[model samples]
Target chain A: MRELTYREALREAMAEEMERDERVFLMGEEVGHYNGAYKVSEGLLDRFGERRVVDTPIAETGFAGVGIGAAMVGLRPIIEFMTWNFSLCAYDQLVNNAAKLRYMSGGQITLPIVFRGPGGAAHQLAAQHSQAVESLYAYVPGLKVIAPSTPADAKGLLKTAIRDENPVIFIEGEVLYGHKGPVQDEEYQIPLGRGEVKRTGQDVTIVAWSKMVHAALDAATELAKEGIELEVIDPRTLRPLDDRMIFDSVKKTNRCIIVEEGWPFAGLGAEIAYRIMKEGFDYLDAPVVRVTGEDVPMPYAKNLEHEVFPGVEKVVRAVRDVLYS
Target chain B: MDKTLMLSLYRDMIRIRRFEEEAARSYSRGKIGGFLHLYNGQEAVAVGAMSAVEPTDYIVATYRDHGHYLARVGDMNAAMAELFGKADGCAKGRGGSMHYFDVAKRFMGGHAIVGGHVPIAAGIAFASKYRGEPDVTLCFFGEGTANMGAFHEGLSLAALWKLPVIFICENNLYSMGTPLYRTLSVEDVAVRAKGYPMAQEIVNGDDVLEVREVIRHAAKRARTESLPILIEAKTYRFRGHSMSDPAKYRTKEEVKEWMERDPIRLLAERIYALGIANEEQLKAVDEAAKQEVAGAVRFADESPSPDTATLFDDIYYEPEHHEQDEKVVPLEKRRQQASV
Candidate 1:
């Protein structure tokens, strides 16, 4: 095992995948000469040359659509958005074409493409730049939305996404890129749509994904101080939601609290809460509570930003509220 | 044009013309619903251009796609069924007139967004070139789509990458009451191709022979050079934009002037003058085309609607990897491995 940052792991995954498969390639605005805007593809362009590691013009819709078409014709393309915020320009290609082609064509075509980049609120990037889209993409049927919080999960999940037959929106938190974790050296792939329990306990189950998983762990530590032992669950893939795992865990713990970085209204937390009621309501000792980002455009000010986003305090409060109720 | 070919072209043009007319009538009678953009005078463009290309080649068109649909892949019945929202339609009735798609015949789709299909066609052409396939994609769009950013981007990218694509812009003068004069400074739509350094050809779209000859050359050049070509087919729409339009833009005299150049009649006159067939034989060909269309209508009407249970069926690939993963450790055991 080797300790690598999430950014390095992602770059390593892209390089390894490209070396292994001739059909696999990476394309984006700064992916080639600049070595990726966030350095996620630091040494890839020099290693693989320009055709495989293309530096496209500022045409997200054009390149994204090109990748989809390439994927349909047997090339497995990995398209990187500078950030998930810029994906709005390619919404039609992602939503209408990439997501619907297989079904619209009656399963005649398979789009083996991966649209990857940093997602969710980062630093002081306000409003248009700092919105979390986990719930937004998860709502689509034909896409597999995966958000990886750790370096190992980032590498393994990205490899799996590149090899996936369908188009996958691989969301990596921008702040988590510098976070290092133990990753295996050899070929390893974490299966999509599977949930992993970060820390197990018997009192309450906290379901989360991506960066919120880190917050859940922080919340779990604080909640344990008050004698509330919580089990944190990271649903690696959002679309093929691993509800069965959550349901089973909730049934055992008799309590559930969901933490999410997206907006509260119609957020992924809401879906999890609904599922918990539908499947594990009778076993619950308390009603499911949710800690989510405030339903407003993310503000630029630090204090207001902290208030809008879900943090350890909010998760702890929600967990305490659920346990006490 | 040869006597035999002219007669055949005339027959195809008339089939598309009469078929769209029937569709407009049916739509007015509530047999069809949704946005139905009739391509009455535009029949010659679709028939002429489609005839110029090979069967294995691809076609991508705009929302007003019935003429292109009947001319390329499906019969009049499947087209009508699609309009009527029947399961036997090309998209299994999920997509109405605007969203016609036939994968078997390499007819990609009728995308509703103005310039949406442009990049898709370019992508298809790129795929063909990358795969070393000698196939060209013919992307059909109205003059209105030229104003979109996608059109400029797609055309530029196609030319830059040297993709084998022929953009057939059917300039019927009006983009739903907004004429070409109002939308663009340059009257000729072919001038847009100059920005991309692509070869452009302007054809009298109402004359099937002119369109056919131009498309033939354009398709050939696209196939050989792996480059983009543009064809501006200056045609006219005989009907309203859709069923709801009053067609208040132009006078009847203008319509009459364009009708004088009706491609089907022109081709028929030329075929008869060239002694292709007697009047009786020509009538038989016309009757056969109509009968074929009538048979398709019967077939679609008799076909059953798609079952409701199937709505959730094709939404996603049903995780074939699940079965493979099941052979591994269960969730309980996997968690236990975490301890190691």
Candidate 2:
């Protein structure tokens, strides 16, 4: 076992997969010569050569469709959107072409492609650049969505996404890129649709994913002093959720709190809360509450941005509300 | 072109013309639904260009794709059944008229969005070049598609990469009721290739031989040199954009004028002018094409609609990543919940 940042873990997984399979290639803006905007693809061009680690112009729709077309034949393409915010430029290719091609073609095409990049708010970058679009992607039927919290999970899930037989939307944590954790040296893959119980307890359940997972863990640390003993769950795969883990936890805790960074209205949190209500309705001692970003399009100022985003305090207050009510 | 090649091209144009005519009849009778874009006037471009390339070469077309499929795959039953919305269709009835796909034939399928498939076609060529394959990709769209960013991006990348993709813009005058003069910034779409530093050609689509020769050279250049090219096939549609429209935008004189240069008739005149075939033989070719289309109609009429029970199938190509014990709600339970 060795320590690696989330960025290094992703680079390792891609480099390893490229070594294993010749068909796997990376293509995106600044992925090659520039060593990636965030250095996520640092030194890949030197190692894999310009052919595999391709660099494209500032054209998302073009390159995205190119990846889809390549996938249609035999090549497996890793189409990187520099940031998930920039992905809106090529949303048509992802939503219409990539997602629907498999079904629209009546299962004739096997799309082995991954659309990966950093998502969610980062520092002072406001409005356009700050967005967690997992819900929008998850709503599409033909796509599998994955958002990993830990470096280990990021590496493992990314490897799985590359090898998967369909279109995968791999949303990496924007702020968690530099976060370090121990990763195994041996080859491994974390299966999609599986959730991990990051920390277990019986008093209340706090479910989260990606950046929000850290906030939930922090909230649990503070709540434990008050004998709350909050159980933390991270459903790594957003779409085909690890439902059994969430339901089992809810049944035990008898109270649930969903934590997410996306907009509160029609967000992934709404779906998770409704599912808890449906499946664990009888077991619940209190109502399932959601700790999510404010409904407004993220504001600019640091304090207002802080107020809009979900944090440890919000999760703690949500836990208290579910417990007290 | 030789006599055999000339006759085949003539016959191919008639095949598409008759198929579209019959499909239009079926639509009038309330058989097919959704968009039904007929390639009535643009027959020469598909038949002529598809003739120049190998079947292994890829073909990606826009929503008005019946002609491209007929020219490349030439499965009249499959194409007609696709329009009929039957399970026996090329895309298993999922794609409808707008999206006709035959992956096995390397006909990448029909895309509905005006310029959306351009990049997909470029990507197909990108894959071919990456794999060291000589197969080129022919991307088909209308003049109206030139306005889309996707089209420019597709061309720009293809040229920059020196990928083997030929963008064939069938400038059929009207882009869904709006004429090119209104929709396009420039009257000629081929010159736009200058932006990409790509080779360009403008062909009189009524002349099947010229189209065949242009694509032949373009495909050769693409295959050997891996160069992208933009080809504007100056053509027009005889019918409205789709089955729904009355085509009130154009004057009867204009429609009548373009119809006189119809590729089917133009090719027949060429055949007769070259003394390749007599009037009776050309008439026989037309009759045979009509009969072939009539048979396809009968086959489509007898085919079954897709089963509602299997509606949920093919949404994803399931991967063996996990033995989901409870990850997914069972279909039966989901159905029950939906009812509730």
Query: TM-scores across all candidates?
Result: 0.92, 0.97
Among these predicted structures, which one has the highest DockQ?
Answer: 2
Q: Pick by TM-score: which candidate is best? A: 2
Runs of candidate 1 with Cα error greater than 4 angstroms are: B74-77, B319-340
For candidate 1, what is the DockQ-based docking class? acceptable
Residues B1-340 of candidate 2 have per-residue lDDT tens digits of 4999999998888899899999888998989898898989999999999999999999999888899999999999999988899999999899999889999998888898778899999999999999999999999999999999999999999999999999999998998899888888887999999988999999998888899999999999999999999999999999898888999999999999999988888888878889999999988998999999989988988999986654655666764312432356556764543221
TM-score of 2: 0.97
> How accurate locally, in lDDT, is each candidate?
0.84, 0.91
Residue range with the least summed lDDT across 10 consecutive positions in model 2 chain B: B319-328
lDDT of 1 by residue, B151-264 (tens): 877788788889999999999999998888899878888999998889998999988888889999988999998889888999999877888998988899999999887777
TM-score of chain A of each: 0.98, 0.99
Native-to-model Cα distance after best TM-score fit, residue B102 in candidate 1, in Å: 2.1
State model 2's lDDT: 0.91
What is the lDDT for A45 in model 2? 98
Worst 10 residues of 1 chain A by lDDT: A101-110
